[model samples]
Target: MEELIYFHDHALVILTLITIIVFYGLISIITNTFTNRFLLESHHIETIWTVIPAIILIFLALPSLRLLYIMDELNDPHLTIKAIGHQWYWSYEYTDYQDLEFDSYMVPTQDLNPGQPRLLEVDNRLVAPTHSPVRVLTTSADVLHSWAIPALGLKMDAVPGRLNQLSFLTPRSGVFYGQCSEICGANHSFMPIVLESVPLNVFEDWASSLME
Candidate 1:
């Protein structure tokens, strides 16, 4: 996620620089009284314009391609979880643990706690330990759905009968919220995703409690 944010900032800086330069050039042309017809046909100016843009594109493409490759590369995961999308809810399974599975349904507006967010609270949250590479496998039991969390820079489609994978490592413990990005059906807006990151020992205790 940090890498994703850094790349976004890098691209934004480049885009801002390009926009300023182009705007300045446009202002200069509009304000200038001198008309040089020969300058319009100058191969030197044409080459400069073409080469500069190409160079800028290379700068953008190199980092973009690098990130792409990194995202596609799956490392050895410390833990694995499977998230199955239903019509209006999500079910999760801790692959490393026997019988550690549960269904997460959104808490209705009337059932929400005083400080809880409306349409975002869930009955159960997908939990994992902090600072560990956790692999998430996603698929749908019904129609198409998407599991996306912007803070984690994670998004993957959940297609029927086809599992998709992504992984993340959170440096700190916190609760992250997300929603189903794909429009599946009538209650599409109800399904929400909540992930809780805790310490390794705390996570173990929680898991053990569930198993018992």
Candidate 2:
């Protein structure tokens, strides 16, 4: 199901372009016909034409709603992490690991390695285990910020006083990047997010080290 959603993301881009082209062609045809004919005005033709975008919407809404519900439905999570957004940095707490916490700040572009992506790498990344259900609790310390990761299909607003919950299970190990989607301050663009998913054994080892 995850793979299907990932594929749909790309498919949606193509579908969107096709939809735009078809709509454009239809409008052009209508305009050309009305312009060439002096007796019929475009407004007269418009009265007979009713766009039932609802039909297209119905098809698009089903899969999207299904995915939304699935993402929100909480199962027995193997781990839980709390993320708090501050002025220009992020703090993470592992609730299941004795509430161990740490701060994750963005690495400056000048200090990045040759293969590292500018403005996307961070000093400390939120780490988790692959193929494990992890629940995330998000909140803000001061202003509103959004935690978004496109690959995981996760995005939730971090409100100052409210806690928002989200969950995901990464099928593979890799580093996923995101940023402060909402404009919160002067350095909003500099507040990047990086998540590293490792093997279960590696995660357990890392968690143990954090405890020490």
Candidate 3:
């Protein structure tokens, strides 16, 4: 996510520079002394058009390549979680722990508690620790579905018989939400993905309580 933010900020700066340069060129052309032939053709015009664009292209490509590299770089994960999408729900497995697995069903709007988000609440939320490297594996049991979280900048396809993986880290404790991006079935709209991040001690306590 930091890489994405950097790319976005760099793009804004480049856009501002381009805008200023264009306005300056337009004003200079208007204020300059020009004959009919000077307006038609100039030794500087052709060279400027070609050379300036090449330089701009190189500048744009540098950041684009950097972003791609950042996206593909995979680091050693401290925890691994596997998520399998069902017809209208999701199942999760904590592979790093003692066979901890559960199904997460979306909470019905009628059953939602006060201050709870409608259609976004789930019966079970995947919980992890903050400031830790976490890897997520995705697959589908039936139809196609997409596991995505916009805030974390993660979007992976859940294809049948194939596994896709993505790694992310949350520096702070918060609840993140997402939904099935693919058209699965009639109840697709009801299915949502919820994740909770807490301190390492809190997460350990929560995991231990499940066994008790």
Model 1 superposed RMSD (Cα): 1.4
Q: Write the per-residue lDDT of candidate 2 for residues 29-117, one digit (tens) a residue.
A: 87884355644556755554434455456666777777678888888999999999999999999988785899999888789989999
Off by over 4 Å in 1: 33-39
lDDT of 1 by residue, 39-91 (tens): 87899989999999999999999999999887877788999999999999999
Q: Name the runs in model 2 displaced over 4 angstroms.
A: 1-58
Rank list by lDDT: 1, 3, 2
TM-score top scorer: 1
The 10 consecutive residues of candidate 1 with the worst lDDT sum are: 32-41
Question: How large is the C-alpha RMSD of every model relative to the true structure?
Answer: 1.4, 4.8, 2.3
> What does candidate 3's lDDT look like per residue over 1-212, in tens digits?
77888888888888899999889978877987344687459878889888997998888889989878766666888889999999999999999889688999999889999988999999999998999999899999998998988888878889999999888899999999999888888987878999999999999998888766
Global lDDT scores for all candidate models: 0.94, 0.87, 0.89
Show the lowest summed lDDT stretch of 10 residues, model 3: 31-40
Candidates ranked by TM-score, best first?
A: 1, 3, 2
Q: Record all residue pairs in model 3 with backbone atoms less than 3 Å apart, i.e. clashing.
A: none
Error of 3 at 176 (Å): 0.9
How many Å off is the CA of 9 in candidate 2? 6.9
